[model samples]
Target: MKILALNGSPRMKASSTYHILAPFLAGMKAAGAEVELIHIRRLNLEVCIGCYTCWARTPGVCIHDDSMADVLQKFNTADMVIFGTPLYHFSMSGIMKTFIDRLLPRFEPWLIPHPHVPGVTGHPERVQKPYKMFLVSPGGFPEFEHFDSLVATFKQMARMENWEYTGEILRPGAEPLSRRSLQNLFTGYYTLLRQAGEELIRDGRISDNLQLQLREDLFPGGKEVFYQLAEGYWTEQMDKFKVPQEQRHTVPLLAKDLDSTPMAPAGSNITNDTSKTGDRYYVSNEVIMQTMTAMYDTKAAPNLQATIQFQIIPPKIDFDPGEAMWYLEINGARCDLHQGKTAIPTLSITTPYEVWYDIGIGNVDALEAFTNGDYEATGSQKLLNDMLHLFPRPEPGSDDPLAAELDTLMMGMPTAFNPEAAKGTNAVIQFILSGKGGGLYFLNIAEGKCTVQRGAAKNPTMTIHCPAETWLAISTGKLDGHQAFMQEKYRVSGDMAILLKFNTMFDTHTN
Candidate 1:
């Protein structure tokens, strides 16, 4: 298949629309399709003057001598045409709209009903063979309803032109590609896009399920997160404009009229905007333990008689490597939790309490935490992998009652609990977790006391990046940290030898 994509975003290579299309192009190439992407903004495109000269002076060719001629040639030769754009005022960008108008020369002014067609619909007169058209549009808002008008226009245009409308890829929350926090959500979305492209080439259509997934929220936090991100971006832009803080909240130049315009109350189907500022929300540990217990009771848990014991310890003096520990034991289909050390533990997990706090709140992906070296496990890899699945995944920004409950489980509270671990120590370590559910964390140890903070550390003795889940397994003694490091599951910087002293500095006493 030969595919030609017209990128209408003014941002061109930097646009979210292009970011979405890149993976699709890769998938198409994998499926043996020849693809060409053209950034429309780079071309010298002029608005249509409604000159009718193409109809009267020259047939099937525009009279205006410009870049449109080249665009027309590409359009006529493509087996499938993809129109990619960002939503502007509930429709396509001005450039894209003009590009559609310039397509007029390809169709004769006369419209007549097809003799063999059962529907008896009028069609535009064209010289080339019929081709399929697909739409790719990504909006910053979280609602698909914002695309209703734009999609309807394309459907109508396809009908009038007697062309096939293969499908549309409309995604909301398009800012995830640029935000570190939304990396996990964005990964799932891009994977779906790649799969959709492959199916489109092999089966001539994207599966319905893939289309549904494409429209799903890119952030688990839903509409509120979407608008919150938007506000933050706008605020940053406002700062660049040198606007005063008092005037910062005023309506934007483009939105002033709309804000003043009288409008009817929104319909029941409308999802109201909820972008109010508040503390960061996360799932609670209590909810996570309860969910795990429920999963253990179900078929998800294995029925093994042999006991597999695991210990979880924080980097605190009270949690000294050998004295203080939280033991969680798995026997048969039951799971038991107890405080203090286990004489002979199967595995032990060691990390700062904040890392576990992020995992419990569903802010960090367990696997990412492992790969990032957020935690280390010291036991059997097989059992560690199995036990990891015992925990349920919380839906990001889901509207389900349970999801909503988890979102606000502990609305306002501190998650980190290591106040004395840094005492007598003088080192700073930064952990950068990747993949889904991973974020930056900083551990500052000074004068033997330790304090943890989110984001980067000022100056660090050592830095680590790993997967969250694997880190958890390694921390719990389920997976060997040395083996993981050797296998390239994580990377380190600064003084590598300092990492070996972490046990003594943080009091990670092995059983």
Candidate 2:
């Protein structure tokens, strides 16, 4: 199925709207569908010339001679017409509005004298099929009625063209989109697009399952779409997730599940402290974990196919023994996990991509990303500093498409699969002792997964013998990775240069 997505952001794909849509489109492509995303910003689109050559010369064709002609063909030729734009001033971008305005020429004055709605006049006899209007807009909060008023303009276009409203999809929390969120949105959105295409070509119906999952996964606040509905329009988002033929009713009939609460609450603030010291504005990183669970958008659920872990090197921690260790349920049982019971809460983070998503001049360092307004930091700044950090974006090499793709390949050693540290020039892999023997270890950059091991192998190039609690300090650079060397907690032999270079690798990567 052919799905044509018109990215109407004036900045084109660089706009926040397009960033979110990219993954969804990619998912559609992955699902074996023909999906073409055309950026309106790249087109030399001109304002309508008001010449009615389309009617006399060719109906449904604009002859003003501009790129809209190509866009129009794409629109008319596809099973789905995806219109993406960021809400600029409580309305669609001028880029999209102007484009929509030009399409007015496609509407001929067919003067059909018809009855009107309760208050309106001269309405179409019947809406046509196949031409569905798919709309996309991104906002900071769940409520977008104010910003999404563009639907009215789109409705007018649909009315004139005699097409059905496939539906307008609103993407919440689209403003200040993160690299991870962008990838998720693109993946989810494209999945729907591809599914829509397949249904149109083969089944003559869009896959309801895919649509619901997409809405639940990407638009967690979609339940609010019907707050103003009369009595029953406030149903499931077409219950695309509720399987079984009988329960497979589209969102039209599914009533609101009152118990369900939406994440990305309107006006909600997100603060992540990237600092790694006593400056923890949020508690011991435990509050941060609770906050993540609280703000979790189950609609955009993550699949744990890949793993990354962060091993906090020690003496970095500022917390005292009095700050109660967070109680965690593990392996169908209670504690008995880490010795000392304070398994420095390891954060295994995964989004659409790894840490290096932001490209080019806009990119900032890990510390700067927090202080310089690159990320939303409410508290726990030091926790970020205490944990792994971002490395500089690597210089691009070769014209490889996958290079342009996300960091699909692993960047470093797996924390769980602790490999024997070879005495490779200037460095030797070392793990800060949580105990003398058995426990999980993490890598510097947060490639997450649980594994058993507490100390390095005998005769390892460098051995760090700090107490289990010092993992945080060593990793954070507070205790100093080299401190173990001086205090004898860390012993180095065999190859010092290789161990030095190895330590430098951790500098570029965080713990």
Task: Please name the candidate that would achieve the greatest lDDT relative to the true structure.
Answer: 1
Candidate 2 ranges beyond 4 A from true positions: 51-53, 56-63, 114-129, 178-511
- Summing lDDT over every window of 10 consecutive residues in candidate 2, give the lowest-scoring window: 352-361
lDDT of 1 by residue, 100-208 (tens): 9888888776656753355666546666578889999988777789999999998877766666899899876675564545556577778888998899999999998
| Predicted model with the maximum TM-score | 1
What is candidate 2's TM-score against the reference?
0.36
The list of candidate 1 runs beyond 4 A from truth reads 114-124, 178-185, 243-511
Error of 2 at 14 (Å): 2.1
Assess candidate 1 and give its TM-score to the true structure: 0.46
Cα RMSD for candidates in order: 25.9, 21.1
